[model samples]
Target: MERLTIDDMKSIELEIMDEIDRVCQAHGVQYFLGYGSLLGAVRHGGFIPWDDDMGIIMMRDQYELLMANFNEWRTTERFKLVSYRDKSSIYQFAKIVDTTTVIFENFVGKKAATGVWVDVFPLEHFSEQQGPALLKQHQRTGLLRSFAVADPSVGTNAFVKLVKRIVCPFVKNKDLYELAERLDRIALRMNAADSASTLVIDVLGEGKLEKMFSKDLLEPIRIPFEDREYFAPSGFEEYLSIQYGDWRTPPAENARPVHVMEAYRL
Candidate 1:
């Protein structure tokens, strides 16, 4: 795979977000620029400085509709829909363009061109509880079961596999949606430590991260998304560390934002 420079990734992120916004707006579904995307809007008012991707969340039903419509757009425009399951398990975290086209092809060999990309996450329900507490409980136990029940091939990506092992049961489809941004923090930290290593599984010198997955923490919520609703899972603080490492502290001025968009939430 080719590595993208900061500027290249930013352009891809905005282009995809524009396409996504168009579809969501036409459908009348409530779509939030979420995860790092949201953080980018908040902190940098655009793309995060070091970020290389974009993410968005909608309720399951809306997301389903959005994807269906997006597929039509893909066929009409001659763009490809990259499926992680087909590419590699590691790619499960997102879908990317199979070949350079559009900005990718145009920018190839350029100083800042990047792989074209986008990710859609489904936000589940979490009680009105504080964020940290909810994060912990999920990481401890319930999230594991959720992952186990997830499609058999989800973990083809090592980091995703580790995430499944930890938060499967307690993590419902909805919870996984909302929790994606949070877990991304952990992934980013892992990336910082070693770009080549798998943060979810490889970071654990012992079975610590995996062992943390065995605990039981579940708080389910039924929330509305698009025309329908679904259950989302969540947990507590311990789960946060296990899944995301230490995100408890606020970032320093020079510190890189965990999810570039996170700062914009407020």
Candidate 2:
């Protein structure tokens, strides 16, 4: 198996994204570049110089429709979709993964390393009337999500590692997973009308509140990414501002976060 360079990783991600575009187009599913992918499209013409991978998100109904028929819409045998529904999946969201290659992430144990994939996030509604109450619920999901991948290897510093070790014993992985299932059920039961003003994903790891965006951004606008055009949030300027305070300025070399990935053909 050949080891892959960052360029090779990006190429695989682009291939997956292209397939996603085809499927979404065929199903009339509206998705927009999300998280870093969105930031990259607006800040750089394509991916950030050091960035790899891509993300696309859709509203709950649109997401369901896309995934329900994704297998039939896909033209390639090399890529497949995996979601929380899969027993082996640790994430609550879906991923379009390349079966041909694998990648090791710094934050997880070696056994958790997975095939190169693009994250497919599902956007859920947040109510205006129950804003404070809903936010606390969202925060709990972040806490559980953090613990799902917790270990000494999670952080670069020894002090942080020690802290994780202290908390590791009391938290059982299966119990947390069961809690997640319950929360997902709660979300399903309390499902609100799609008219909420704010939208958020399930896992808001670090910046909990800052990760949310306005519902007004739901309307799609085409933007340039790599060599082709892709959909972006209509109110991207406002959407990005809510996510990153000064997104236009690139991070300093010394301050830039390290992204560790080791890829190889399977």
lDDT of each: 0.41, 0.72
Give the Cα error of residue 162 in candidate 1, in Å.
16
TM-score on alpha carbons, each prediction: 0.42, 0.87
Clashing pairs in 2: none
Instruction: Please report how far candidate 1 places residue 213 from its true position, in Å.
Output: 21
Q: What value of lDDT does candidate 2 attain over all alpha carbons?
A: 0.72
Please give the clash total of every predicted structure, in order.
40, 0
- The digit string of per-residue lDDT tens for model 2 on 82-119 reads 75555435555668889898888876656456689998
Q: Poorest 10 consecutive residues of model 2 by lDDT?
A: 200-209
Candidate 2, superposed: residue stretches over 4 Å from native: 172-207
What's the lDDT for residue 236 in model 1? 32
User: Candidate 1 lDDT, tens digit per residue, 71-184?
Assistant: 565433423444332332122234433235333322111211223557665433222223334345435433443353364334446887676556544433443333433443
